[model samples]
Target: MQVIPLKYGTIFKRAFGQPDVFCQFTKDILGIEINIDKVHTEYEYPEPIGFVRSKYDLFAEDTEKRIIVEIQQVKEDDFFDRFLYYHLISMVEQVGGYQAYGFDRTVYTIVVLTSTPRDGSINFSCAVSDMNPIDEYGRTFVVYPHRLVFLCPRQVNDKTPPLVKKWLNFIEDSLDGEMDEVDYPDTFWKKIMAAIQKQTINPALLSEIKDDAAWEEAKIRFVAEGVEKGLGKGREEGRAMLLKQQRETVLQAREMGLDEMAIAKLTGLTAQELKKITK
Candidate 1:
């Protein structure tokens, strides 16, 4: 399949707005079906108390299976902690906190992460409660909505389970433009293309992405963030200059018999600033 990866914004729109894509993705990855019939973020989950809002790439669900999936793009540090927070909120919201029943209705928490690729670390790693920690067994802690499946594209391989393979391939191929057509679901190709076309549109952002035909121009755009940061520093210096001028003016006034309170009120200067003016 000729899979095309989505840009930052398009990810949210396509996943939530396109139910076919959303529903199939959930089923293929997490082995569950959602009522994609009516999927909306603010409409469904309705961010609750203490939930950190706007910290995720996608807050998704397969309502049929009562499943909620959050996609987090990991940058560094064990920021998975935030993903964990969102996941817990999702679970809490689903089961109505401490009041609701059936804490384990096969809830699946999935994370799709893109990072600077690590070799040797499997491209896909899945974690399930080690079923036998006591006798080499562990528990799933059925006290809340059931399972969590995280698909870090930086971690998968052919050895990955079938479902995860489809997802990992989706992410990998979409990124590199060399999609493994045979391995993915039939509809995967079309869904991805539509999302990408949507991204290539909006000529303004498109121009921003593709600007810099000259390598110098490209380099400047890439490091444009540093330029933006320097503007902050520049503003600090400008403010200092103005402050220095104000201090000098206040000092001149004081030497010429201006009252300290009068100088303070005129310059809107703090007592500390006024002291500097005098000194």
Candidate 2:
């Protein structure tokens, strides 16, 4: 059976929207117990200009902290910068409408990358203290502890914990060909698989998935074609520039009262080649 694309926004919402699933996901990423007060999907941050800004994949907050969960299938060069920007925006939105001395709650940004990064690390994390100096006890002035957690599905292996590995497998594996080969753990894997199966049956959801897939496919194709065209154009321009420089050199040599033979020796052009330019 074809599995739902977890990286897709609609499918991600359908598969993990359940409070139970989202809570489990939170714990798996944070490696700590969390009581989620509410879960919002495709949540729009408060745009001060009211122009409708970017929407997060998942936004959940509790009394102590707010979590932003995102699934990125394609890797970009400025991925870290983008996530940092998103993290800052999330923090800003907390106090957007209300006045406060500082953010009362911490912000956590969790990103699941379906693609492998250059370093091939399965997991990467960053915190404020890593970039700044702090004492052994840690800095007391830090109120909002913003963190970034990245999980690369391709790099998950036996060394990973059972539950974490299972969750990664569920998100990445299609479970189509080798059905009986791998035995997934009972709870989270089963819940996600069952939810995907159930959600796939909804005709509207299925249609939406198909449409989104088509749109994404078209986008990839367009980008690939654009890059190819750009490269071709660049090569053409490069050749033209080289030819112009060669011609300019020949003209410059002639201006200096040098014969065709001297120009040929200086520019590494044959006598015939020099004649072709002078002709």
Top candidate, metric TM-score: 2
Cα lDDT tens digits for candidate 1, 92-160: 555655665644444566666655333334344555421222423554344433556676665675678
Q: How do all models score by TM-score?
A: 0.55, 0.76
lDDT of 2 by residue, 1-279 (tens): 446757677777776777788888878767656687567988885555233366788888888888888878654667767777777776766664555547667788887776655565434322222123467787655433577777666667667666576667766674231222246557666666666663345898888878977987897789789989999999999988987888889999899999888888899989877767655
Question: lDDT for each of the candidates?
Answer: 0.56, 0.70
lDDT (Cα) of model 2 = 0.70
